[model samples]
Target chain A: MISSPENTAAVNIHRDDIGTRMGIWLFLFTELLLFGGMFFIYSIYRFLHQNEFHLAALELNVIVGTFNTAILLTSSLTIALSIAAIQNDNKKLSVILQIMTLVLGAAFLVNKYFEWMAKINHGIYPGSDLLLSKKPGEILFFGLYYVMTGLHGLHVIIGMVLIAVMLRLTVRNKIDSNNFVRLEAAGLYWHLVDIIWIFLFPLFYLIT
Target chain B: MENMPEQNQKKNNTGYTKYILVWFTLIILTGLTVSLAGMDLGRITVATALLIASIKSSLVLSVFMHLKSEQKAFKVFVLVALFFIVVSFVLLFSDYSSY
Candidate 1:
């Protein structure tokens, strides 16, 4: 190996593609376990109160849930496409796709806001007096609904911010065809968000 | 290690059409789950919805997340994590169901 200034700089930068990707995957698994705990609690409660679970699920608007699911799904597609575009050296297309992803994520959150407000307006929030008057099973159902969906919404915000950062990097030529690990990592995070919603939509809105 | 290039050497440029096809399939699966929700399938509805969801997640994992092209170590790590989750589920259910 020849000792040189450029070699020293390259070593200092240290682009370890395989290691970076593996680290992200490990982080993602921890995230899965974090939500997995909640899913377990929900299953146990649902089993104990099947009837209330069914009736409480009816309060959710399946149409809105489905529409939001589609939005997240489309967002996942856009992020995936952005990665592909970057991999193909099409920087412009990648930026466009990332913007589309951010738009779709915002759209999903808007729909969620309206859906939550509709329930809140009817006094169905976690500790509202109206909720207190409901049966224990129904109360538990709504409580879990709020907590799970709220946490998922938080993940959406984090993912959007990460993608936005990646967009800036892409524009600055920090993320390009030969150096796109950051963008790929961001894409993985976004897809994981989408996957979580895939299970959440069916479990919360479609199973009843 | 010192002489390694800073640029990533991964040249696998998956086409746009493949992702679109996967997206189409995911949409169809989403539609199926929603439509099935309207029916009174009793206990089977849960199973059907979850099964479809599992399929959809697998698609996202393998394709969109690039898990398919990832190294064997990544796949093994994923399986290990999933195995632990399954074990936890089984243990929790065994205790609760027995009670």
Candidate 2:
């Protein structure tokens, strides 16, 4: 019946205890299936109109895409370090690293803001402009582009919130060496975001 | 295996070195991919770029994400996801070619 400082739950619970780990894994599997559906749609559309997809992709900003990829990769590294720090019982370092990761995630979103703005400035909105030579296929391409990348961006926002929660937990000493599963779960989500970008980079920016 | 091995031992291992080296290689590979975009490689350009990106992703998954060290069930989960991804791609391609 030990009481936790931040909550009424037990304080010495093993972070990666079997049940907790299993639950997180289940949630992760659901996430995979969810995104997997979207990827399927993307493949269908891209394969049907390869030329249109490639031409539409050429309109994207490679510099911003590359920068965002690098930013997300660095955030993944920092989150991994945060997990390592917590496992080492370095509470302060863990909190700082978590905050740093959050900041980097936000920075990536900000860059995305400018990138989207640039797209709009070029009159690339869905169903509105025939800026490219592809005609009807361009509309489909932009539709999938917005839906896929928009969903990915929403995940990034959620990841930021998750990290913030873990930061609070670390500050209250609820996420020490013995119980750092939350950080690991959040780290897993962050890495998945990075993985999404790994595919997106080529699909959007490297088109012929 | 209640805990990860000692920090010093883990740090000294070849895997750690390989992870850092892969990160460096990723940076260079990204630059090369973008630079090559200037040249007209036709559709093959996208294929080649994606191939490199996939390789980089595998390195990150195996090392930084610690997929190689995770439990067998977790590994199976990832494999299952990949299996379905392949299935979806195949199905989509078949439908796409019918058009």
Candidate 3:
């Protein structure tokens, strides 16, 4: 299977080569910087409107936020284990763990759905219709809230697609001990999503 | 296949173990951060929470993602990205705090 020109010579290019892997890390690092900018903006606004932000944050359901945090943490563990399984050349185990990770990710989205539903039901939305009957600053806080978490949720969706692609690669025997960079890349993306939530949990749910 | 390096062999086993341990530690840290949030420690709360999050991100980057094992050039790429980010934050916040 290593017969391709990319697989020849002392420097292997069997999908897990240093160059390809570095490319993936470079991609992930760019993603980190992108989200880092958004986070910096959030922090600036939070600092400026600490009282309003905290009051707005208190309107969120801590129960749902905590559950989503736990769910994402478990999913990160599953993805890490999946990568480990691939490195050990355990194909079936890797696939199983990937599917488990996918399930956990979907569960997180579902929990988020209910959380947003609760928020909507309580009238704690953005725009002029926002609840929490406070000041204009408080309404702006919810504006940032919807923008940040909604963008984060969109990232979670993108991460699920990335994981599915990795799973397909695994099923086709394209991933193994000699070539698992894609899985590693996807895992890095998933962990970034988890890290984003780690910040979001405190910013939106616990700041009060 | 017969002449694989011993370091590779050690990496195949111990590396995987270390990743699993990091995962477990992350989960524990998540729970700890959540509980700590309940204490209402004022400004320190967000700072402490973000500090833990940074550590968790570092573990994931270095271990499960194998950033620590990468080439110096690649490490420099990441460091450069982070450096720019910090610079931007500093500039922005300086303008912010002045207002």
RMSD of each: 2.5, 4.4, 3.9
**For each candidate, what TM-score against the reference?**
0.94, 0.84, 0.87
TM-score (chain B) for candidate 2 is: 0.74
Q: Candidate 2 residues A37-95, lDDT tens each?
A: 87777777777777788778778888898898888777877787787777667788778
- State the lDDT at B86 in candidate 3: 79
- In model 2, the number of clashes is 0
Docking class for candidate 2? acceptable
* lDDT per residue as tens, model 1, A84-116: 898888999999999999999999999999999
User: Best candidate, DockQ-wise?
Assistant: 1
TM-score of chain B alone in model 1? 0.86
Superposition error at A190 for model 2 (Å): 0.8
Candidate 3 chain A: worst 10 consecutive residues by lDDT?
A9-18
Off by over 4 Å in 2: A1-18, A129-134, B1-22
DockQ for each model: 0.73, 0.41, 0.48
Better of 2 and 3 by TM-score: 3
**Winning candidate number (lDDT):** 1
| Model 1 TM-score, all chains together | 0.94
How well docked is model 1, in DockQ terms?
A: 0.73
Off by over 4 Å in 1: A1-12, B1-9
